[model samples]
Target: MSSPEQTTAIVDAATDPARSPRSLREAWLALAGLSAVFLFEMLDNSILNVALPTIGRELHASTTALQWVTGAYAVVFGGLMLAFGAVADRFGRRRTMLIGLALLGVASLATAFVSTAEQLIAVRAATGVAAAMTTPGSMALAFRLFGADGLRVRAITLISTVGLVGLAIGPTAGGLVLAVAPWQVLLLVNVPVAVLAMIGIRFGIAADAADELHRDPVDVAGAVLGTAAIVLALVAPTLFVDAGTGSWVPWAVTAAAVPAAVLFVLRERSARHPLLDLRLVARPLVSSGLAFKAATGLATAGLGYLVTLQLQLDWGWSPALAAVGMLPQVVVLIAGGSLVSPFVERVGLERAAAISAAAVVGGLAVYSLLGRFGYVWVALALVLVAAGMRVVGVAAGTNVLRGLPKERTTIGAALVDTASEVTSGIGIAVTGTVLAALFTGDLAASHWTARQTAEFQQAATVAGLTLTVVAALLVGWGIIRGRSAPITADDSDSSAGRDDSPGAEADAPRAAQHAG
Candidate 1:
């Protein structure tokens, strides 16, 4: 019994002549489901950011412990995404989605009730794993349902919109809840949302099997190595900082991670069944997409943290006010994502992505000098950065998904999500560490005397400027590289030509053919 929306969607998909009505319909449902699912994910992402101060006060946490509240979730979340991508391939997407949602809902409920920092981190980690499982599957389902050049643009737009909103709303929502309801309420909010999404999937979605489910063995080794490499990369800085190892720890982690990654790549290349098909991702479109996404994450995530600090510490705004000030960012994000999507599908992905990446670089550059200006100027700069970031982010995801064969959608999505998480975690740690260090130095420059307050303000401005420049450069590189790359797939073609025979994965060339 499909819902009326589903029925209408299927009918429209069938009769529309662009593609099957059923396909369009499923795309819409997946869009809605993914949007809802990402709301929870992003909610969790920013929720911890807002609650950190409160959690510290209540739990008497040290800085190391405080970091774990965030780090724990990230480590588990990112580590599990690739593994879950395989699970989605093995099981049906529908069942995986429902089960993942259920686990997330339960974890959220438990998170709200937990009392200690350890308890919160543990519960959040569990929730992160659940989210990892659900996120990649949502993407896989999107590809399966939408097909190439079908409803992908609209779906990505909707997902981007939801994610942006969730990111924006998290701080305010968490603050309001903390004001009236306790930290637990933040965790509990996922329950109702998950219940609704469960209902939606069960009734609205039909089960989908991966196209080559039986042909390939799961690449367990690659999965482990990939997850370890990413997680180690994210945690290395923190480990260096926490262990008081100065410079050696991060260098060591980097050294280890590089070889592990190389080994994983070699293993993936030769293995009969790689966890992810490396050859496909090695394509210009896919590689560029991953790089673009990572750059965008580094820029926005770092900048967002800096802005929050500026609002709260320097401007003396409350959490609620800071959150409200960021509302404009959310609007810009959705608008930017929505604005670029149709053009991406029409003009081709690489061109569209390149344009968006340029916008991001340009925006970050424009905003770079803003910290020394008045609040209004800074606010305007934020809007520019947000809009640009939204555009690039959506284009990157759409391009990567389009470049992959349908069966590799989950793996590709895992790469996308994992890169995003890993990059963001680095952004937060690096930006936060730099700002903290700068602030401390400024305080000392004042001789720990009467000049403390004014010096703090100066430090904040400097920190913002520093981050703006770094973000600008990262985005600039992506824009230039993205322009030279090929777009993902043929806009007019379905993947109907894809061979489903055994070893079909081996037969597929990457985007290079399209480039030529």
Candidate 2:
């Protein structure tokens, strides 16, 4: 319930662009803080990947232990995102994010003292928990800062660009650093990033208002179910990549996910205060945006995994050369942020989302049909997918937030990220499974026989085509669902009607007071 004055203030905040930050420059500190949060998410995994062998050597770790070092992070991060999103919305997004940043700094600092694989894995898991708390808040806060769609798009673009650069250069940078310094420096870098993010967010953003937070009791049952479902989902993909397709372990894990997901949905439907309101998610725009994001994630990750193998294992390129070959994707992801605003302006957000999503499918098609012909086709596929991913990443996320109630923006952002993370895991699983099924003999052998080469090409083609069809269906569904009329802030569920009760009156002014 809210008073008329609170309602008016909320509406004014939604409709008035003049009151919002005029430009990225005007809100540079806040944006910097948000961008730094994103940079940590993107850079942490990529940089550490290059140091796995070094870590194993120094720590005398087994292969399984090394896998957990990265796997633990992904599992913990993905598993906790939705729960944390709900927590942030109820308590305070800023407070939760700042706390998460501090935790990230502490966890990263602990990496330097790690002497065992188990210890390192524990540290990575801590960082993942921190990431889950902070990452969604970044986008939620940015969306809250701006009233205009244009400004929001630009802000997201700027933030994503910084993250993309971090992701693109992480491997190379890690390699260079490992040449001269200890691997500990890589994780240690997050301390400074966490510090900067804390300063900017603490000072630059306004505090949360009472009216901006939901007062309902937290749905503990729903949170547990949701976390279990997501954890199983994220884990199944890695199991597929590690264990062969015939292994019953991955199948059992996959089967467990179905029940967990079903139970989560049931709990949410019945919960007095569900972690994620299913009704809101079923809204045309939110569902469609998630579909688009999932499609892009599937295509981008699947293609990257396959191409890396094709270049190195099949084409006999050196590790450094294969890394160089991936520049097409890296370049586009880093440079394509500028294109998002203009493209969205020209085609409109919905159209841009659809077009970009289609391009991802199209890119997969190119790789499937012609990649074996030469490096040129693979590079083209990379560019197309990267270009599409760059646009849809921002557009789809914006659409999801736009469709959600202002108070639920953090969960909406989490949904966007969760969809991407889950599907990317699935993507890698699909490609790896197909390759394993089709290609025989030692995949990692330095010298492959002619039959193995032929088998590898066949496996890649089949995998690529499989991804293309799946991505196309997802993108097409998204476009169809997204065809529904757009939901503006004024007409959103939170603001569409006024509450006239006396109790509501007191709540309104509190919102108005913190409207800035």
Candidate 3:
């Protein structure tokens, strides 16, 4: 659609009282459009991951290039999401979402035609930009469609469940596609899906432009600083894990991340319209809530890489069978999602987070003993872990929305997804590097089979133990912290920053019914 046509259609939808979802039929249709966007965007992360090995061989790419292909989208997405969310808030979410569909279509087409690894990586990055643009708008549109808390919660849960389903199915779907056709065809699938999604949005979703043309500055400096910091942090670990690479680059990037992070925080504090408020991190619930969500990413999308490598690289299963083997975990996620609301309502959000972490730790503990036990046993353990992760995700997401004001729904969605995406990248980097190191254990091949076997087991053990320690810390934090009130979104105000008045930050956004 042309820009004028899109604007006109969306504006007409917004103004047409008849188009609004006052009826149940219209509301369900609206949810379908928004949820479809969420599904396609997140599904990209793991779906492409499955194609990495195929891509490497076809393009004559190195291991590092494969890693870049997998990580580039997430790195860019994590870096840009907050800025895009804030943009959606300032502009119209409907308009932004339409643009996102267009970009996604273009990027997917480019990915299908890439001849080199570098081009594939760049095209993947473009898709990340598309995701950043669309996701906040997707969430905000849902929020606008349903004002009642009960209805909104249900809608968000359905959207999240679809996302979970996408993550669950991505590898399996990718494998299935590769079984019949080349990797390029797999990417080309997105083009048609994108078109269908745009049609859904055009007809079903109501337009919701910003009341004002402009409210706050876009904070370009903060976005740049934040992007630099995240990219450096992610790259450091990947380089460190490369067997022959020097420590200098990793250490240098790590060092640079500190200043960039510091500057990003400062920039947000001072900017007229900050991409995200730094003080939101200061809230105990917000911080812990964010962490809980990240853990979900670690267990779900991130762990998919580890499992894929193990299944395809180590066990030598065809991608098709490996994906089938993953079905148990998907079943667990679906079943587990139903349990989240009741569990959070019963135990409170903080305590539920700790419990979820414990499940992850326990699952990893089982995975650590994969050599001793079989893949079946490891799969069973992951089921428990996946269930727990779902609970943590659902609990944290509901609370985060409650804490954020209704007006800043786009920004809140951005922050929530950013935390998960960044940590997913971290989790993939940490675990994949460990596995890669093990896979490349000795230059002098002494019992090559024996050496690879030993290293593979060792890698699993190390990654499991590392995550265990992290989850255990979250357990402590969740248990000891005082009950935090759900925080609201902060407006463009230096006054709250200046006045050290008691509870000044607390007063910024209106608190809703706490899911806790």
Candidate 4:
């Protein structure tokens, strides 16, 4: 989705000696700079889970307050992501990211000085807002920097590896920080990283003029409605539930969703500038990619949550010890991220998705048999998990942006990201419920007395088997859809400016209708 300005900057950066290197080294450095931001920003997502108890003790936070400290971040980040994506498209991606970086640095520094739980919660919320602006913009920037499909795929693979590393590194890294410093120090560490990354960004990307002047006005109404819908959709489900509360919460939320969704759709349809172009949503690449990414989040998060239960609750391993056992998973993830591009480019998107599905099924099969062989099976399973995730992530991203207009690329990326984020929350809820039920059932097997590891082991086996079945069905569907969906001419092109179609000509007005 490189704008003419971005295209010129990249071309100039290559030809001009005053900026980045002329060789492939420039691309590597650029990817590293953006990936650094992604790694540090996303690392915070799970890092706080380990330090919550420490934060609670020190700040005397109530259970609800502690949840707010973390939940505030999730809520704000999820709510504002698409809005920021539209903002990035309207403004400049690099500018959007620079502002985000500044905010993250300021918020991280402020977080270190917070005295009360409320202050911490506020600081986390600010950081979440910064992350929302940064996430899709970063990916959009990556696309603009490397417009070639091959190069874009490589960049995506690298970024996905950094993300998984960030996720996996959280508890391990947080545990290390807790060993030597206060929880506030965890927030403090990002300041220097942010500063360093800003420097990388300055040198790595060319300065481009603002886009808003040329683009349609920002979709303020759409932003408000879309943000409200996302926030309400995510928050209401959890916030309205309690032992004494009736089933009215779900129904009420559903009722509320109708108006919000209807309003948002109506706004997009009629507005001079729509936040989400309804036309793009009709495209196979856009629609299917978002769906698959959601499935990826669901399957990946579900597996991780269940494995965590098995490792710590059932097997009596410490958090640090459990992370150590995930080394195989991490290694495979790194390798798979580095390698998925050629395979994806060689085969089509759907076939690659199918391959990823097979890998997940194989991995879970190993995990389901873990009781018989020991932890060796765990290691074996993780290798397949890592391989599967990399292919799925890369292919989904590639397909989403394929044949998409450069100017509106951020919009599509935003939708894919929003799906992943929302479904990640869904995965947490679903897996938590399932695992909780499994734990209670294990206790019941022991006649409500002392539960044995054997009972938990049995539970783990069932969970593994269940996930395998789900994955098989899910991927099978993807394979079917992939088989049926038609690939556009732009998808096969080496470059993105393939405007040889009548449909693309019609898209010009849609592009001008609104930013994102």
Predicted model with the maximum lDDT: 2
RMSD of each: 6.6, 7.1, 6.7, 7.1
Residue pairs that clash (backbone atoms under 3 angstroms), model 2: 3-504, 6-508
In model 1, the clashing pairs are 13-20, 13-21, 14-21, 112-184
Q: Per-residue lDDT for 1-516 in model 2, tens only?
A: 546654454445434433665555656678889999999999999999999999999999999899999999999999999999999999989999999999999999999899999999999999999999999999988988876666777888889999999998899899999999999999999999999999878766777777678888889999898999899989988888888788999999999999999999999998887889998888777888999999988888889898988898889999989989989988999888878887877666667888998999899899989999999999999999999989998888988887777788899999999999999988998898888888898788988999999998898889888888888999988888877655444435563122334434234323332332
Clashes of each: 4, 2, 1, 3
Sorted on lDDT, best first, the list reads 2, 4, 3, 1
TM-score for each of the candidates:
0.79, 0.91, 0.78, 0.80
> What is the alpha-carbon lDDT for the whole of candidate 1?
0.66
Candidate 4 residue pairs that clash: 1-406, 273-513, 273-514
Between candidates 1 and 4, name the one with more favorable TM-score: 4
lDDT by residue for model 1 (285-311), tens? 577788777766666676676676667
For residue 93, model 4's alpha carbon misses the true position, in angstroms, by 1.1
Q: Quote the lDDT for 74 in model 2.
A: 96
Cα lDDT tens digits, model 4, 1-516, are 446655555456734424432223445546666887778766885888889999999999998898889888888988898888877777777777889989999999998679899999999999989888887766776766653445555667777678778877788789898999988888887788678667756666765434311287888999999988887766654553221124566447647866997899999999987888787676655566665676666666666766776677666678679888878878787666756765765564556766875776777667777633677877777787778877877777666666366666666677877887776655555544444455544432313324555555665666566656665666666656555655566544522443435454234323422211
- For 21-110, candidate 3 gives per-residue lDDT tens digits of 432233555667787787887687678778888888999999888888867876777778778887877776777888988999999988
What 10-residue stretch in candidate 4 is worst by lDDT?
Answer: 507-516
